[model samples]
Target: MSRALLARNGRRALPLIYGGRRGTDTLSGVHLAARRFIVDMSYSAHFMDFKGSSIASSMKKLVVTKLSPNFREAVSTQTVAVPTPGDADLLVRNRFVGINASDINYSAGRYDPSVKPPFDAGFEGIGEVVGLGLSASSRYTVGDTVAYFGSGAFAEYTVVPAKEAVPVPAVKPEFLTLLVSGATAYIALKRLGDLAKGETVLVTAAAGGTGQFAVQFAKQAGCHVIGTCSTNEKAGFLKSIGCDRPINYTAEDLAKTLKKEYPQGIDVVYESVGGSVLELAVNSLANKGRLIVIGFISGYQSASGIPPFKGGTLPVKLLQKSASIRGFFLPHFLGDYREAMSSMIQMFAKGQLVCEVDFGDLAEEGKFVGLDAVFRAVDYMYAGRNLGKVVVEVAPPSVSNSKL
Candidate 1:
């Protein structure tokens, strides 16, 4: 006989398979040992019951408290009912969430013009499909590991629309790279930047999650990738990932280095660092060079707003060089680029592209686990502490071995 046993994690009650064993009253000497083993496994490990057919009633989630200029103070945790998927949606049990500056900006109520407070937080995440909506297509099934860079990722369980979820292999792909970071690097380079072979490419803040991916994509395009970072440690990582040159911006004058090293001017400038850096990249662009503006993290938390645009004189410089600057907002261009995500994953599978992700326990360095660690991850990024993509393990790296 079988019985449903509730777990401490509160996910759901598990249906335990065994002989007709009731309670302590019905236990014999040999049966008592077997019952005790089952009980220990049930109560101790959280996942045994998470695999239960019945869904969790409530889940842990981070919600925006109020609209404040400061992101750190604007959010708090709450226990909420797990959302059921709509007809075309899938119910995903999240394992990890990749932190980005956008999360901080969102909490500060900066980016989205119409966004208000008390909303679910986050964007990029990796998880498994636990439940499927009835009218949804069979393209995805329960237990399929998937990656999603969408809204409402700061919860243990988030509903992903069928069209947005990117299915991966049984062993999880480095979803941190395949989702947001990889898409930004691949799409922006091909569609907006128009990268070419043998051309010189400059990536600002190159040690960052998206920036590192940008460096690799630029290199893979046969461009000479030059990365700029604040520390030598970050610069070293850039070189290891196929960067041609890594300029320590804090140690060297970026403008002077660019002018002296490449008198012919740069061919493609992937300028994410703004202020003087943006202007400098524009000034150093070769004839017909294209500059793709990703994001300026230099002043994200600054009360004074965007950094100074001291690019000497923009009109005269760009007119002489015949170069153009275009801005890329990933949210504005998300769904249209699933093809790029697929390409990145295929390249990774072939060992052509190197995808490095920090999974807390998976790495030897700093670790950030669970929803509560998100704020610290943001601060780590702000402090330029991460060498690769910073991913928070909401659950352990893999859950397949566990009954859940």
Candidate 2:
């Protein structure tokens, strides 16, 4: 059945169409209709008897309360009106929102504080397009599942550029977590790392959000994958996610372990965790190896006000081996947005990617704690307690029915 038909039944939905010039049509109009249907369906049956268009239209969002040096006082929540989509945007009914260390960094004022505070915080998530603007394209219908990029996924609804949302294959909702973390890993591996088949790839913080995806992506690219985690438990988890060798950073020396495992050194290193691990990773690089600096989660909460890396070491390593280090932020790749998104979607469709998530023990029931829980999750992430992508379920009832 077409998404439009399914949408008529008031089922949650995502985008249905794909690439083309941007414009609107009857199909695009279905988004508004579907949203109306959902709003109508959600009301009490008594309100259903009323024939007026009085839809309750507020959304709850995780907001930054104050820019603090510590994790506490960094995050909070507020209710706001759901935003309308722009001509090139889609208003998504967010389901599962992925939490990353960067979100915490922004909350703690690591970035420019001039951006202001009490704003929504989130990087990426999966959702259904409930509405679009008049000039919106037909690349998606109201009910198709999609992965999107936007700042407000920490809320019940978010607006993403239509071009920035990717139509997901018919996979379980849990896999959307993979789409969130896995796609980032895939883009970093393919675009930044320039991963080649049979090459050896190493990922620091390999058991964390982006690292888990890096391990699986590198393995799918036919690379011998090695991962660094803080504990044996996490190391085992990394192996389950396709890392051929898992180095327990707490138990072993990374440089010695890498030298013992691959004496020739690694072709690419996905450096998401900086600090000593990053230092060890650079030393383990092979001739012409690429080190992709994706994040510096290790230094996220440093109270000493230290720089992420002592400047001399990176340059010294680069000069010694003639290796290169490249930094990547997914948003900057928006120029080739279509191609990057297509590559991820195809890999997902082919089952070449695996996504792991730490759904919080509290998530077992439909009940969720609060934004405080989000802070705890982020803390656990920095403390190296989470096994995979740590996602805080916003509006649990909305996502309770989501598939894995």
Candidate 1: regions farther than 4 A off: 1-50, 53-55, 171-173, 359-366, 397-404
Error of 1 at 107 (Å): 1.8
lDDT of 1 by residue, 1-404 (tens): 12233333554444433333323211111111112112222322222123443456898988888865456787888899887676678778888888886676688778775988789888877777766553442344455566787888988889888777776653253756667777887788888878889999999888877888889988888999999988898888888999999999899999899999999999888877788788788888999988999887777777644777876578787889888888888777865576677677667767887777755443334578878888777777777767777888887644344223
Tell me the tens digit of each residue's lDDT in model 2 across 105-164.
777666665777777777777756666543443454454456766676777678888766
Candidate 2: count the clashes.
12
Clashes of each: 0, 12
lDDT comparing candidate 1 with the true structure: 0.72
TM-score of each: 0.82, 0.76
Give lDDT: candidate 2, residue 388. 77
RMSD of every prediction? 10.4, 7.5
